[model samples]
Target: MSPSETPEVVLHDLRAGDGLPLVLVHGFPLDHRMWDEVARFLPDGLAVVAPDAPGFGDALLTESEPSIEGIADAVAEALAARGVERAVVAGMSMGGYVALALAERHPGLVAALGLVDTKSVADAPEARDNRLRIADEAERTGSVAPVRGMREALLGETSRATRPDLVAEVGAWIEEQRPEAVAWAQRAMASRPDRTAVLAAYGGPVSVVVGVEDELTPIEQAEHLVESSHDASEAALVLVPDAGHLAAVEEPEHVAGALARLHARVTR
Candidate 1:
C-alpha cells in the first residue's frame, strides 16, 4: 500500500465534550458499540470518535488484503474526515494491533495510546495456524460460530462464573458479526508484525490496561508493554480487577479511570 492510500471506513463521531479528541478502536467481530459504556465514564469536554474497522461492524473491507497497517490507515483517514488532526488513539484486542500500527505508520495522528487487553507481539506459529483454521471455517460456513466459540477464552473466569448477563451480551455482539468480517480479521491479525518496537519508540504517554483475570492477553503482556515503551516512566500500567479481555465492558469505570488519567497526563 502506498502512503497515500487509506481504506475508507465509517466513523461514528460523538461530537460531545471539550478537550483533545479521543479515538476509540474496537476489536475483531465487534463494532464501536463495544465502547458505549466506557464512553459514558470519560471526562466531560472531550471529543470521542469510535470507528468500525474495515470488515468489522458497519465498515466494509475494500482492501484486497486487510492487513493491520491498512486498517490503521483507515483509522487515520476516519479521524481526518472528522476534522481531527491528532488525538489519543485507544484500542482493545485486535484494535490494539491497529493502534500500534497507527503509531508506526501514522505517528503524527497518534498523540498518545490506550492499549487494553492487547499485546505488542506477533502471533506465534501455532497461533497463526489456529487463526487461519478459524478463518477458513468462517469462510466455509458463512457463520461466526467458530469465532464465538472463543468466548470462554475471551472473558475472565470471574465474568464467566458470575456475570452471565454480560457474557450473553458479548455473545450477542459476536453473533451479529458477518462471517466474512471474522475471516478477514483473523487473516489480518495472523499477518500482523511484532510491534513492540513501536511502543519502545513512542515518545508520548501510554496506558497499558489489562484485566487481572484476563486469560487472552494476560497481565504479563500489559506489564511488558509498560516496561518496553521508550517512555516507560511516563506510561501508566493499570490492572482492572475481576475483568477479562473485554475489560472496558466488564469494568467500564476502571477502564475509564485509566483513560481519564492518560488524558489528564497528556493534556497537562
Candidate 2:
C-alpha cells in the first residue's frame, strides 16, 4: 500500500481506488503542473499519476541527451515501480509524443490512449532546425528566453484575447523550467520520428482532444490522429472550444470531461 520503494515522487499522484491507473504526461518546456486542474475533474476512484518527463520538472536532471524513447522508458519504470503494470495513458503536445513512444516501446503497458493538441508527424526540416537553434540558445544562456514567446503560439486566439492572466500564467510556468530541461526537450523533440504508425498499430480505445483554436497543432492534426488509428470510427474526438494548443490548461473542465469519458470507455 505504500510506494516507499518508488524511486521518487515524480510530480503528482492522486492514487484513488484504482482498476487501471491514468497516467498524464505534460508537454515540453513545462512540467506536470499543466495537468493539475484537469486532473481535479476526473471521475472518482480513478487513480491518476502525472509524471514530469525526465528533465522537465522535479525529476532528476541528467546530463543524458534527451530522447522520446528515454522519456518513455522513464515513465514506464516509474509506473512499474509503483505497481502499475498497465495504464490508460494520455498526453498533450510534447507529452503526446512521449505517450505514443511509451505505447510503442512498452507494448502492452498502455490499455487506452489519449492525445491532446499533438501531431503524429515528425518535424519538418525547417521546424527541426529551429528547435536545435533554440536548444543551443537555451543551453548557452541557461535560460528559457529563447522560447519565452511561445505563449502566443501555445494559446488560441480567443484565450489569448480574453485571458491575459492565463497567458501570463503559462509564461510563468515556462520561466520556472530549468534551462537544461528546456534544451533537452527541444533536442529530443526535434529528433522524434513520425509516429502515425504507432497509432495505426495500437488497438486500444483511443481519444484525441484538441483546442478548437489551436494553431500549432490544429484540428486537422487531431483529425489525422483519429483517422490514423486502427479503428477510426471508435476513436473519441473532443475539441475544446475557444482554446488553443494547451487546451487542458486553458479550459481544464472541458478537457477533464473529455478525459473522464475516455476513462469510462476503458473502465466500463
Question: What TM-score does candidate 1 reach?
Answer: 0.95
lDDT of 1 by residue, 10-95 (tens): 88865487668888889877889889899888887877788897767787766457588888887787777667778999999898
* Candidate 2 segments whose C-alpha is farther than 4 A from its true place: 1-11
Q: Each prediction's Cα RMSD?
A: 2.1, 4.0
Off by over 4 Å in 1: 1-6
TM-score of each: 0.95, 0.94
TM-score of 2: 0.94
Which residue pairs of candidate 2 clash? none
Q: Please provide, for model 2 over 1-268, each residue's C-alpha lDDT reduced to its tens digit, 9 standing for 90 to 100.
A: 2322222227478556669888899987788899888888887888888998766678866656568877888789888877888899999999899899988999789998999999899999999999999989999998899999897889999988999999998999888888877777888899999999999999899999999999899999999999999999988889899899999999999998988888888778
Model 2 collision count: 0
Whole-model lDDT for model 2 versus the true structure?
0.86
